[model samples]
Target: MNKWIRKSAVVLISVLTFGLITPTQLITNVNAENPSERDTVEGARLGSYGQEASYFNEAEVDKDKFIEDLVKQAEMQSYQKFGTRIKPVIENEFREIVMPNIEKALQEIANQFPTEDLLNLAITESPGKGQSEKIFNIKNNNTNTDVLRFHVRRDNPPQAGYWFNFHYHTYHDGFQSHHELGSIYWDKNTPPKWMS
Candidate 1:
């Protein structure tokens, strides 16, 4: 009876060991056949499986499209701020001088942020009306904070006519300093109230 019990124990141990090892070996073989599956498993183990992995991949793939869309929105917002009254007067200069700088600044800002963070960026819908000096702001949706603000201030430098000073403030500097993006000269007469 003792020998029979020992034999049964040995068989049970062997079956249990085989049960444990076979699945692992099968998984290893399957992973070896498709290396990407191995990466997926590893990624899953490292906590980057479903949503996070998809977000990272999508951000990388769609980054350029995202930036392009933001640029288009910026242009539209600027035009809206200029309104019908002031747009025709400054449109050409704004397009030629200020727009390029704005694009460059946006590109630089995109470079500073990670793909995930960049994906979360959004442009403010309404540019401030009247003499508010606000064109639009690029903000982080996740943080509910502005990353960069584009403004066109009417600067009257005594002898000079009203100049639309296109500038941006960045979160990096606590939004304090003006980073100029070239300026457009409005006539000596005060320009129409923004969005008028």
Candidate 2:
């Protein structure tokens, strides 16, 4: 008789609460049906409500993948800045001389920041088209601020034709100091305007 009464009370409470406190079996089935919803709820519970739960979990990161992607994007942006006319002439030298330093700089950045912070980094797409001294910038997506800027300036040192001075600036020094990567000589004939 006591067992029967206890069962009746349990059923009555469940009915009145409308499954607000669900059975473990029901929760398991619901979670299986919609795993993303579970993740979202978990994220909310962890105070990462709007953002994906996977992003907050550091274990999901690919480690070197972010740096590799950044390097590839940097190469593409450099070529874009060089354009058709300039690329043909300096492409070889740029690859041999400038690229290694760029890689080093990127690697340095990867080492400096935690992997989770690196995940927030992205390369700016559009390289400057004309005479602008912009190649690409590594920006933090969350803050919308540049963390590193790579640029090439046409330096004509008196009689020394044209030299593309490849360098980068970091946010650490307020983007004022030019940390030289290397330079590629164009010619005495004055190279065409960038991206021409």
Clashes of each: 0, 0
- Runs off by more than 4 Å, candidate 2: 1-57
> What's the lDDT of the predicted structure labeled candidate 1?
0.78
**Tens digit of per-residue lDDT, candidate 1, span 1-196:** 8657655555565588865434444444444555776676654433211123434454253556666767777899999998999999989999999989999998898888877666567788789998798899988877889999999998999998899899999999899999999988899998889998
The collision pairs in model 2 are none
For every candidate structure, what is the RMSD over all alpha carbons to the true structure, in angstroms?
19.2, 15.8
Looking at model 2, report the run of 10 residues with the lowest lDDT sum.
44-53
After the best TM-score superposition of candidate 2, give how far the Cα of residue 84 lies from its true spot, in angstroms. Answer: 0.8
The CA root-mean-square deviation of candidate 2, after full C-alpha superposition on the true structure, stands at 15.8
The 10 consecutive residues of candidate 1 with the worst lDDT sum are 45-54
Candidate 2 local lDDT, 31-69, one digit each (tens): 455577766665434322112334445665555655666
